[model samples]
Target: MLWFKNAIVYQLNKDNLFDTQAITNAVNACPFVPCGNTDSMRSGWVSPFGESQDNPLVLDNNGQMLLRLKKEIKILPSSVIKQALAEKVTQQEQLFNRKLKKAEKLSLKDEVYIDLLPRAFSKYQFFWLWIDTVNKRVIVDSSSFKQAEDILALLRKEMGTLALTPYASDTPLEKTLTKWVKESLSFPPIILGDEIELKDAVEDSIVVKCKNQEINSQEIFVHIDSGKQISKLKLLDERGMSFILNRDYTLKRIKFDNAILDKNEDFLPEESNAKLEADFMLMISQLTDTFKSMQKIIEEIITV
Candidate 1:
């Protein structure tokens, strides 16, 4: 599976961290624990090791590390909980031979919820990340900040004392993106696409999106003059990879043009285990290059 569609890059300091083994130990401590029927949720890490490749930690010749985490969550259906509680409430009211008070009904509901929690169905998801100790960066394989935070929060709980911040430049990204569209500061080697997601920085909630329209058109300039800062932008790199650059410096809506994707088709392994091995290898290799360039350009463009 193409597990990581986007990246949440972080600037990790090169201190306190000793070796890969330390991280491997932390991961081993928190393998996926199946949620019990009554439990609401249970989340933890996992070793994505298969029958053929059964190792919790994968280290390359360069010393870069990759780790996987599995989260299992279970939640009882609201309707089912309500039905059970209603039935109990009716029996209690008949026994007492009087109407139940609001506080009493609520208490009964809380008890029924606890009783039904053990029967909740479970769901599963996995998170994988790369530890670039050489570069002092921890790249999370997630699109949204909430998902990204889940990984970061867990890492801190496991390893302790992780002070990493989201990737960004000295100047605010929204301000820099506004300059790109208003003054048309087209950075060389990266072409701007005809799509944008603008927001009113003052209000923070107001937003405007322009799609398939010329980014340099006078109509867009009008919106720019009206204080709409660029929040999401579309661009194509030299290699024809297209992606949306969010103001937060996280990429979204990424698509490596078929030309690039088709090139990897020949090397895909037939065996399931071998294919996963090859896929992750190729993904980490290609994305490392793409993101290295991406981080540099963003930093340079936004910084004074």
Candidate 2:
């Protein structure tokens, strides 16, 4: 038989029952009262002298209790309560383990494949770029940087005083080019010859002067990687004139020319590429770690 020990007894009024708040206040006010072991049992009688006529206490409307004390109230050690709680916690942990093992036995193929299919892409890297020529902008696929810049210039020239911002992606160039495409053509302001001065050149990248005198010139670098489908561009601003880097630049294909027209159907190819596989795997591992953490919480709850 289980030994029931370490219990608390609460004496309450026989009439004018107290609300939960009143009982809680009474418990807090009297530190010597024997409140139950669990938080939920704020006002209950312990069967210290075995079950008798006085099983539960009654409380007044104000949660006041007037009873003659048979003995002085004291804080008893909760050794038996602690032991019972420990046993209950152990049983819960065992149950949680069994459930987790069963879940692991099920297949995860469907979940993984669903999460992989609909290309996950972010534009966090290139959301805000200040262009002197155009009022608004969108990036298109192609190798001709000069043509794209010219189009943006014309658009800026047409839309005077409005802000022209470039839209770029937030992934590594190789992965972006494999699965994304642009579909519209809006021109920008004309590039003035005086605004074309080279500020600085680093390696193969050059900082080109921007047309707006209030803003600093944009730094541009062009580099090619062997396995990359498009050239990578790095933009920089020296003074307060530059916009923050927030998007990634990607291209559908590289065309070697400066006079390509802005009217054609563009499509980004999708293939079984390995460039982004490692990064994707890392993200998946993070999600798995979160799940394990939740399982640990359940184990803790059952044990306690």
* Best-fitting candidate, scored by lDDT: 1
Q: Against the true structure, candidate 1 has what lDDT? A: 0.74
- Candidate 1 has its poorest 10 consecutive residues by lDDT at 50-59
Off by over 4 Å in 2: 1-142, 169-248, 254-304
Tell me the lDDT of model 2 at 63.
20
Q: Which stretches of model 1 miss by more than 4 angstroms?
A: 14-18, 49-61, 267-274
Per-residue error at 61 for model 2, in Å? Answer: 72
TM-score of each: 0.87, 0.16
Which residue pairs show collisions in model 1?
Answer: 37-118, 37-119, 38-117, 38-118
lDDT against the true structure, each candidate: 0.74, 0.26
